[model samples]
Target: MTIRVLLADDQALLRATFRILIDSCDDMEVVAEATGGAEAVALARVHRPDLVLMDIRMPGTDGLAATTAICADPELSGTRVLILTPSEIDAHVAQALQAGASGFLGKDVTADALLDGIRTVAAGDSLLSPLATRVLITRFLSAPAQGAPPRASEDLGALTAREREVTAWVAEGHSNEEIGERLFVSPLTVRTHVHRAMTKLGARDRAQLVVIAYQSGLAQASRPAQR
Candidate 1:
């Protein structure tokens, strides 16, 4: 299936460059282009693209505001926002996430990396530049990530030994492929374990899985600071 996308950026030249790359992909198309944040929302409403490539800085509402509006609207249920920005600053990172952006890509990312990121976000997975992702977590997505915890740690003794192993890497932000590689299992197997682990732990998405890993003492052993 073709993945329709909307491009929003203040720079007409850069927007055109990105369009060239996106249009070159057989399964991707750029359906709308907006030069400002407000127009972005309007175009998004009209086009209903599968994904939005958002710029952090724009006149008027800005990308954070536009992302919040578009993602929050039930009418645009399948649309996910991919924040495309040059800023390594954590404030915008935190804001975009709070606004419901599913992924982020640095402006200087290679063409291949950018395409991969667009695909990842469009597939309902969250992503961030490796370094920027770390920065984001340390600076903002950390403590109080999902509001106050009910206790010092949540229970996880229910998991089988193998299930516990997978949960540790999941909290470390390992993708299915990564987990598979580490454990000498197939990605499909890793996925199965993850699914079962989440069921047993009553966890949410991967991010929350990370939170659980930490709370359950799984991540504690691997804590870089503890070593």
Candidate 2:
């Protein structure tokens, strides 16, 4: 199936460049374009594209607010947002993830990497790697929301013991392969456990799973300061 994409960037030149690259792919196509964040949210509601390629610094509304709006909309549940920015600043990454963005990509990413990210987020997985993902979780998503403490362990009651273990490993920045190797299970098994945990916790994807793992206190280890 073709992946429908909505391009949201203030620069017409960049939008055009992305459109050319996306449309050139057989499995992807640009369905719409937006010049600003508000327009992006509006077009998203109207088009309901599979993915929105969003830039953080738009003229108005901004990508973070737009992402929150889109993700919070019941009608747009099937739509996913991917933040494309010039830097992988941890603060922005954390904010975007908290706002329900499915993935983040630096603008310096190669065309192939960008296309892969679009596909990854479109397929209900996040684009963050294990290490970067860990730092994001440790530094931002793990923090208490509204100055409250992490949710009680009972909050993760829906996940099985094994699922919780897998989630903790994930929050620690282990990939499926790494987790499998550590647990003596196959990568596919690890993926299944992760997916099951995601389903039980009502997580949107792996990034959200990591967020929940930390926020719920299932993974509490801290990491060194990120550069």
Q: What C-alpha root-mean-square deviation, in Å, does candidate 1 show against the real structure? A: 4.2
Q: Write the per-residue lDDT of candidate 1 for residues 97-150, one digit (tens) a residue.
A: 655687678888889998888888787666744465445544554544466452
Indicate the worst ten consecutive residues by lDDT in candidate 1. Answer: 218-227
Q: Against the true structure, candidate 1 has what lDDT?
A: 0.75
For candidate 2, list the clashing residue pairs, or say none: none
Note the Cα lDDT for every prediction shown. 0.75, 0.86
Best by lDDT: 2
- In model 1, state the lDDT of residue 13: 93
Those runs of model 1 whose alpha carbons end farther than 4 Å from true positions after fitting are 145-168, 181-184, 193-227
Worst 10 residues of 2 by lDDT: 218-227
Superposed by TM-score, candidate 1 places the C-alpha of residue 207 at a distance from the truth, in angstroms, of: 6.0
TM-score of each: 0.75, 0.92
